[model samples]
Target: MRRLAIPLLLLLAACSPANSQPAPPVGTKADRLLVDKSERVLIAYAGNREIVRYSGIRFGDAPTGHKRFEGDERTPEGRYTINGRNPKSAYHLSLRISYPNAADRAYAKARGRSPGGDIFIHGQPNAWPGPPIARDWTDGCIALSNAGIKQLWDIVPDGIPITIRP
Candidate 1:
């Protein structure tokens, strides 16, 4: 019995979750993304721990209210995912955002309106010979600087969950 108890204790100790190493900070990797429209901030996180934060995000041209229809120019407000990526995007490298989830569709259907699509978090267009716009200026996508988007493209990957808020 004593020998059995010693082996059991050893096995339990080895399987303890607390024995795991601490998770690396936000820069190393991320499993989640969050965008706050009002504050104009986007954040990446690993579980509940925030990995990084990016500010100065540009939103849809309307820039107020939840997106409801095609050409509404309002950034959506809800939970979504990074569905895909476009390295050859018109804008400098973009990550596709899965908007118009079931709820969005339902809302549009109920109201007999068309739910807009093709939302993304992308950088500025390449070779534009002008200064950055001072405020919200997208069709219905989130905009970041070319440098910022490139950094995010490396840090975030496909299928990560993202939440957008008003």
Candidate 2:
């Protein structure tokens, strides 16, 4: 019984939420955001100084390559801006990403398809139970926790630059 109990406790600890680390100090202003798709992380920066890093991120259902068109189920890669904000987002809070840039539009147009837009860095689903989803789930957006998104919403204003990496 003792042996079984110790192993069970260890398993529970391993399955626990990874967002246990205290967030970095919030800054007065954040100018840049960086998303590492492969690494599944989103980082906020104040100039050259790193202010906040959010790990254990879940990306689009198709978690690789650049998003080219609507319903691609892949996150777009490259430079973009925080073009909008939704204080009453369905998924807690959301910061809109400016996808379908000129290059994106051109590529999709050449392919005779619409380059999808309406990408965002958002929070978890409001209806879900228990902890956050543990896998890639968004259609073509970035997802964080409700609390995480709130913090981000407060700091990262519209027009901030974001660079998404493959």
Candidate 3:
């Protein structure tokens, strides 16, 4: 199953087109972010205007369903905030996602499990020896190319609402 995901992710990145290279340049910063898991697309919105759309997003190993517990390897589904940014992260750059809302914690606790946290929308691992994207790899956070993340890092500010949908 894991082996299959790697190839699928590689294909996903290859086939999907990225609109991150918006021409004419965007003049305003993004106020919200939207992730469509089925299409592997992330869109940033300034007010009602769509600024950029990033395709071929990589996810966790499972790549299905809302994350319920630690080690589920499932990208979470719901609304969250860009709580913080990491300039000195393990990845090229990272914007922390605030997962495990109160509801998530309650659900996991009911099942005697930890609801897991520390998710982020980030780029490739720093000092990685392999290609930029060898796999759709992360515990359960969103992954993007170095250039894609750099573009996002420049436009998206902290405390913006981000919604991840199935």
Candidate 4:
């Protein structure tokens, strides 16, 4: 019994909420969308308050590298706007991220490359047909669960600003 006691106690500790960390502080608004690339979290805020937080988002299949080149398969960093929505997305649904803005174009042009665009925030496809697993999976867009994307579609409007950070 003594030999089993330590293992049992460790298991209990692992399951204890006391050891679980609290969620990061969030505001209560729906104005801004903030993505923390390192944490892979997307927070929706209205003014200074947070409306909701979406976790387990998939990023560019090619993270940790520079974008702005065509076919790089990378998500761009910095600020952008939600320019449009697609009800008939190749995925379930999609919110367009205005990529290749002026600065992005300039940067790409400086390198003699095209700043590839067509970025989006969207849900999994009917073909893929399910929630994202516990890791990143998208080509260069932010992906959410079908249900999560639906909720966001109802709340987020075109022209909202989004900040993607490292």
Candidate 5:
């Protein structure tokens, strides 16, 4: 009975909402990506109107701590732009999120550490092939399902501003 309970717990944890649901499709050109770190949600807005929202984001493994160096597993907090896209990515597909802006670079340089680059808003890994994982598993990068990413690919373009708030 205890062994069965253990497997059940594992399955329950694996299927939890930590990672679930596809992100909303990208809308008009004026749409903005707004991240509320407190809620761990990324919402798309068109001039104060909500269009879509993605939740269950996993931030730096150390969410309460400040990002120090590369691989610190901390999603940056600040204003940035969507600079590019990658059809071939280690993580299925990805939308480049510009991190280490001048400010971030300066801060990291002062501390003698790399601000860590290659931050992206991306989808799940191919290994998870069945479907999007039921919870967050990124190393500080925003993640969407394969289908959600495809939807975003159609709507979002390069040079769009992204505002990330703590």
Candidate 6:
């Protein structure tokens, strides 16, 4: 045991912050994205382990309750998938959320309303070339800072599941 101790200590020293290896251009893959609207935070998980938590999330103007129809201005609640991504998005970058599943469509259709689509987890608008907006201003999408969204874009891939909660 003593013979192995010195080698283990040497390995640890090599991994210290000053001597640490640089992080990869990309990061750990996130299998799941969890958004807590009540807390205004987004949590990314890899495998039962919490990888990243982003705060100061912005929501729609209404910002409460599950979105049901067009122009509702409320973020959707429940299970969805990251179905696609956009680099030429109006926002810095965006990952499409698969809203309006069968149930959502049925619910809206029954009420004679159109279930709005094009929901996404996106960054600030490209035209806004200054400080971040400080209000809940999206039509019904989740908004984060450009840097945060860039990191998410790198780590969270399409086809993963995302759960939005109230």
Give per-model CA RMSD. 16.3, 2.3, 6.8, 6.3, 4.8, 11.0
Residue-wise lDDT of candidate 3 within 1-166, one digit each (tens)? Answer: 9999999999977765453565316657899999998898889888898888888788898888999999999999999999999989999899999898999999999999999998999888898765556456788989887788888998999999999998
Model 6: per-residue lDDT, tens digit, 1-166? 9999999999865543221122224658999999999988888889998877877789999999999998999999999999999999999899999998999999999999999999999988999976556689999999988877888888898999999999
lDDT of each: 0.82, 0.87, 0.87, 0.76, 0.73, 0.87
lDDT per residue (tens digit) for residues 129-160 in model 1: 55445567899999887767877888898999
Model 6 spans with C-alpha error above 4 angstroms: 1-26
Clashes of 5: 4
Better of 4 and 6 by lDDT: 6
* Regions of candidate 3 where Cα sits further than 4 Å from its true position: 1-19, 23-27
Worst 10 residues of 5 by lDDT: 17-26
Query: Candidate 5: global Cα-lDDT?
Result: 0.73
lDDT tens digits by residue: candidate 2, 26-115: 556689999999888888899899888888888899989999999999999999999999877778789999998999999999999999
TM-score of each candidate structure, all chains considered together: 0.80, 0.89, 0.85, 0.79, 0.77, 0.84
Q: Judging by TM-score against the true structure, name the best candidate.
A: 2
Point out where model 2 deviates above 4 Å: 1-10, 16-27
Model 5, 15-126: lDDT tens digits are: 6434334444444643568777778787766678765666666565655444556988877788899998999988768889888798888988999988888888887786
- When summed lDDT is taken over every stretch of 10 residues in candidate 4, the lowest stretch is 16-25
Model 6: lDDT of residue 152: 87
Ranking by TM-score: 2, 3, 6, 1, 4, 5
Clash totals in order:
1, 0, 0, 12, 4, 0
